[model samples]
Target chain A: MNVLLPQPYLLFLGETTEPGYAKTAFGLRDWSPQRCLGEFSLPGATVSTGLPFLTPVQARNAGARAMVIGVANAGGFIPQTWIGALLEAMQAGLDLVGGMHARLRDIPVLRDAAMQYGRRLIDVREPPAKIPVASGRRRTGRRLLTVGTDCALGKKYTALALARAFQAHGEAATFRATGQTGILIAGGGIPMDAVVADFAAGAAELLTPDADPTHWDVIEGQGSLLHPAYAGVSLALLHGSQPDVFVVCHEPGRDRVLGHPDFAVPDVLDVIDLTIRLGSRTSPHIRCAGVSLNTAKMDTGAALRLFDRESERLGMPVGDPMRGGKAFERLVKACLA
Target chain B: MNVLLPQPYLLFLGETTEPGYAKTAFGLRDWSPQRCLGEFSLPGATVSTGLPFLTPVQARNAGARAMVIGVANAGGFIPQTWIGALLEAMQAGLDLVGGMHARLRDIPVLRDAAMQYGRRLIDVREPPAKIPVASGRRRTGRRLLTVGTDCALGKKYTALALARAFQAHGEAATFRATGQTGILIAGGGIPMDAVVADFAAGAAELLTPDADPTHWDVIEGQGSLLHPAYAGVSLALLHGSQPDVFVVCHEPGRDRVLGHPDFAVPDVLDVIDLTIRLGSRTSPHIRCAGVSLNTAKMDTGAALRLFDRESERLGMPVGDPMRGGKAFERLVKACLA
Candidate 1:
């Protein structure tokens, strides 16, 4: 399925707002924003942060057919002050898509303007109307998960890399994004953590719904087995995905669980063992497929050495996925072979 | 706090319907009929279910201050045909409470009738307004969880028993239910399973909200660790409760995971270990404090013998909670001490 918007002129709204959407803005820029004609900000912007800033008319002149509210604010709320600018863009005949908690469609003024102008106002964060409670069915297919030793430690990056590797190997594979960053990258996904706890797995199950039997669903994991604040989300994902195999994602030489010093990150073997057993508690077929190390902290040589050493220890595939190593690719081939 | 209704004068509506709310009806009767004036049915009922059947006026005459719509229908829908009788009850000054998928308060006709009579209409299955994402805080004071091998294997009963046992010992303990049956018994609780998945744990956390450090919270678990159809609920509950200790509730001699025969019940030790580790993944202070065996399948002697053997194996107190055994009480004491 075509998940991302087709090749079309785009305008990013508020790329330079106070308390900037650094994450969303950086993601859009990385996704190649030359495709975006320019960005729109308020009147008095002192510095250009690389990307060109424009007004509504200028954006329309640049052939911008769509406007993306490119900021994820605290609680996903869009300030009322941005409404006038958004309305002006809508009046300029550009459809709008936003990932805000306060739905643009719920605002009568903007919704009415969109209706009047025959423009679409899409809220990316709108939840599915219905999600069946997960059955933990051990469904057929090579479903792989990227679990982590800690949160923000390369689970999403590993999943994306592996999806690319699997596709290159002439296999049917899909990257199932479960977080905001991955969702932004993949173009469409239920922000798993943003979802209500009961539906976290349901969302995962929905995202990875019964595909072709030969297809591999590389689900992006969230939180960590050891994260004090957010482990429930991980547990739900683990159970919901019911993956046949999983890849452990970890940043080498991490002293403690991310954001919490009280919880120490355990050995890679402990993480693997914990993940495999937890994943299999309901669906007994689940196993740890391999390990993906995020060795960004180490030099390339040290990272490679650590990968080789961990590979010997795990006996399964292991590698720095970002560096395009052989270990994770081998793990995928071994599972699908 | 008063969990059950105070000196309830209840009228059971539709006691003899084709799709009988036999479970609910039986539960209410078991809770005691002296508490219920009688039941109401259509005029010509074939057989009596012991509780005297009454019409609207007859129910009011029997001192029925509240009318309970008693059919736990397939979809929990109160049929349109039953609405007239319910309106009649409401008009007769009887407050209404129902456990149904469709909220009676949301039904305009019933809502209007309740308003006309100045009576309270309650939908027991309604979820909490907002449940914050669980932070997995290792809070002080003891929190005990009742996790079962399968659904309907007496997780609720074990929790209730433990709460009473703790209260009898002059300790402050509360029974927090996560299902309809438990809510009916508790008078108030967010139905965790029925809640939107995102809010399941939040609901649990809300129910057992941070209380006085000296209070023990006995949380009634839902679903089971092994049940494929509903393990997500179990996992969410495990993380949401963040219990200092947990009690394993299992029905001895059961070969399968309740309804799904394909999934066999695993060893008690496996369940205990998995529950403890999963619960503490985020909050490391949690542990398995004891085991409560639903030994209804065996005589007291056999049950005690099995408990003793299992207790010795696990090195924890184990017993049949219903039979008033010492193991469960001792387990509570050990955890709280």
Candidate 2:
């Protein structure tokens, strides 16, 4: 499907030139990226902060739609602000596509987990439409929550906590709709066989199915390429509930959240904005919540630094800081304002 | 495990004692008329219906506990209330379990589409704690919904919908915790395999392992039974959101709502009043949302008439009326007031 990327997109097209990325590419049906340079035009902003010299400059020079990637290993999770900056940059209307290592074998944890879950790991030549309901009514003023990292790195808890926080704030927040939950419904009841079947379903259904868990059965968005449920649920709940804002909590998988670290965490800031950019339009009042990697040997201040740096990087205000609960909460109010 | 029954309680004694009732005892187990002779001396107000003939004295004299058991038919799906008059005559508590042969065999159509789904013959055995978390809460001055019925009738939906309606009405309710939502947190998550794998080592973060659609996994409530996640989510929301008023909804099932007609339906009023009966001290103030059957039928007027007849037979004031909406709602408000 033609993924409608938001303007001013900044995405890295990593070893995508390789066979792995191309094999999964939709448009590259019979052909690969090598056969089509500048043959396709970006619908929006595309930024690449990871590859500094060779890839970014080359793609830009070749008029293949590009922006440079950046990073730093400062925060625990990727910084949310950095992604915001990239999104702001994209508003100038760029085409953004995410790129990374082509071979699954190259990524250890990713490979095994993908196999265990029975999902695919593709280059996503043409990103799937995360926002399935593309309508004026569908996108505006809808409640949105970005959850579950591509790698199950504790995103679930973060999503639940934030959902609670939202309810605390009187906003109806739920665990972002998930694929498994949909499958559970399709499979006739929660996964009772799940080792912690009871616990998982309990957590999800605790607040009344719709109240506790966002509807992801038919919507799409908010997950890696493999599990389409993430995207589907996102679309469904957003269509159904239609809240006023969107908040994302993240722990960048690599150093990308801050923009210059050697590691490869998806920046919380960029990812959140990329969500709307890659899939759907969030209410302008849309707010993002960041859960930084505060402990992983990075400076405690690394998360905050990513904010300031990304502000300079992506071009949005140092989106209000949520220090622990205080800053995070204030940011929500700010978004509402 | 010892099934706890009140002392001095009435139960069916022997087949010889009640010639017609003799052949009716379930092969699995049945209370004897001899055993029924002694009431389980439960401390509190006697289960009086103000009808002298309904007195426990005569019931005890008959060497039967003031117990009521509905007659069964070889056919299928009997409404427990069919024996209303018989129950009122003895002013006894009855335990009658029944199932649907035809309906159970039919497949469920969602959004009303058939063929895409396959139906299986379903038979459920009635087990104790059917309406598991029926009454009693840690708090007071708050309204409580007292669910009265054997298992698999309308308890779950009654609890959930009543709880939901209360929340809708700005009342803080919990199915698991006694509150506005009248929703119960029984049967935690299904404890499916998919859920176990997902949480454990991020096996795709899938929720539960698969199960055959035709058969149930039938385990005695494992996975966070003591501390349910459903209750956890709802309670947390209540704690954070703090609603007003609590009205419990009670749904009657096949054996109860559509129970065998041979026996007179129990005083519908009393069956709905079960939570209060059990919670004698607070019986006067508890709010009951006499439930509409989900897995049974959806006739508000009919269900209400059935309940009203039971109440009148037992000599209680006739209820306003049964309704899917406003009619039942009026009674709910009056009870709390």
Instruction: Please name the candidate that would achieve the greatest lDDT relative to the true structure.
Output: 1
Candidate 1 chain B weakest lDDT stretch, 10 residues? B1-10
lDDT for each residue of candidate 1 in B63-88, tens digit (9 for 90 to 100): 77777766666777776767777878
The two-chain DockQ for each candidate, comma-separated, is: 0.37, 0.07
Structural similarity to truth (TM-score) of each candidate? 0.84, 0.23
Tens-digit lDDT track for model 2 on B118-191? 21111222112221111112232233332323322333344344445555566654333221111002212221
Chain A, model 2: TM = 0.34
Query: Candidate 2 residues A175-252, lDDT tens each?
Result: 333332221111111211121321332322221223234322111123321121122222222222333444443343
Per-model CA lDDT versus the true structure: 0.72, 0.30
User: Best DockQ goes to which candidate?
Assistant: 1
Residue B142, candidate 2: Cα error in Å is: 64
**Model 1, span A1-337: residue lDDT tens:** 2235422334454534554554655555654455566767666543233677777677778777777777665767777778888888888878887766788888889989998999888765655567665655556666888888888778887887788788888998888877655665566777766665556666677778777889999889887765655665677788778888788888878878765566788777887887777677656777777788887788988887877888888797788777875666676665565
